[model samples]
Target: MTRSSHSLRTRDLGYAQRVCVAKAGKLMMQTGQLTPRARVGLAVSGGVDSLAMLAVMAIRRRIVPFPVELLLLHLNPGFDPHNHRPLVELCAGLGIPAHIETTDFGPRAFSEENKKNSACFYCAWLRRKRLFDLCATYGLTHLAFGHNADDLAATFMLNLFQNGRVDGLSSRESFFSGRLTVIRPLLLIDKPTIVRAAKAWELPVFSNPCPMAGKSMRHEAETWVRSICAGDKHRNVSLQHALGRWQLDRDALPD
Candidate 1:
């Protein structure tokens, strides 16, 4: 990339970053996910989505009223040995503390012994468990994921179609008896916006090394959703609004 082009890209990314931080900060305040002086861990997967989340969080921390100590936590599933260095370097450049863990979850999940469990399912389960363990070990209050509006919509569709329920992902969820919380600050942002930001910022986005990257049920749901929304640009917006209202209604019901 040339210097002039790089400068323009940085300028564009600065604008995108500002928008992301503003939206994310508002979500954080409304959800009350992060408290002042709280330590939060970002689950960085070296992908565009997670990298964008990392950038947004870093920017939001400086501008928000409360103080949040950000930490980068990565779990290398041993799919690609060279996949994690960019994540570490990004954390270093951001001046945040980072912890990277390696495991053979990828290989093991794809092994013959685990034929019953899909590779995608097994990998996700192991990665999430490892993240929870990391939070417990490091005393982090919250773990932030890179799940966006598309993911939420896709999940909603998956549940509605497969499980016969109107369930979807939540922006904030408590686990382990409220000892730890999982938050998704990008719930209101769409994948296209994230992709633009990632490209503008020149993030070192890495591809998923999993053999079944595009063969998962989630991917199928995404494709279906896109096909449904092909002509109507407002379809996703409608889905997000409906999902939010449904969640609110569910929350209001008696327990």
Candidate 2:
């Protein structure tokens, strides 16, 4: 099927397919996105980030020499059915099979007693556990998450504020639960970049009305980062470069 052109150029990279993927593919090839005969499971929330990720990966698949099998996984952790329908339609449009795992952790779990806190930690932990279990059942070797540079930035500040140290998502991570490896291809792309790419491609999006949406202080951190980086413009690029160059002393800070 021929693809339409316009703002969606980012999603439909036909014009720049060869050049962009070649560039992105080289980085991916070095990072195991080019693993030979690997079955990869992407934890897709059907948001713009993951959708753009799938779009780019689809382009890379056509040119990357390595054989990669891709699958999409979505967890329905008690969100409105109406709110999640678009994601289902999206995977269908992309022609990728999506796995939906329903996990409504009983009522009182995040109830009146826990009103003080949103209980997002409990909810996310539950989701990850289910994702891991699904990976084991399906024999998936690698997992892809939609975490981007902005998320890493937000997390670094949050960690330092909460724990008095700097730490955040790495390009690669290992899940000890089942020896499964996880990769964040978007780690190099900032949220603004992703937004630009998504808009450039005219990709349709879904909303996340989760109970934990705006309450977190992370919003404040993101705003602060936006303000600080607004002037330098290269602020984010510099941050990624610095983090990329980091070598762990392990004992660099107090234990």
lDDT of 2 by residue, 1-255 (tens): 213123223444544333433544544554544467777788877688876776666555555677777788877666655555665655666566778765574232376755554477666666778888888888888888877667777777777776688687766666776468787766656566677666555566677756667765777667766776787868868876565445122212234
Error of 1 at 235 (Å): 2.4
Residue pairs in clash, model 2: 7-200, 7-201, 8-201, 8-202
lDDT of each: 0.80, 0.64
Each prediction's RMSD to truth? 3.5, 5.0
The prediction achieving the highest TM-score against the true structure is: 1
Clashes of each: 0, 4
The superposed Cα distance between candidate 1 and the true structure at residue 208, in angstroms, equals: 1.5
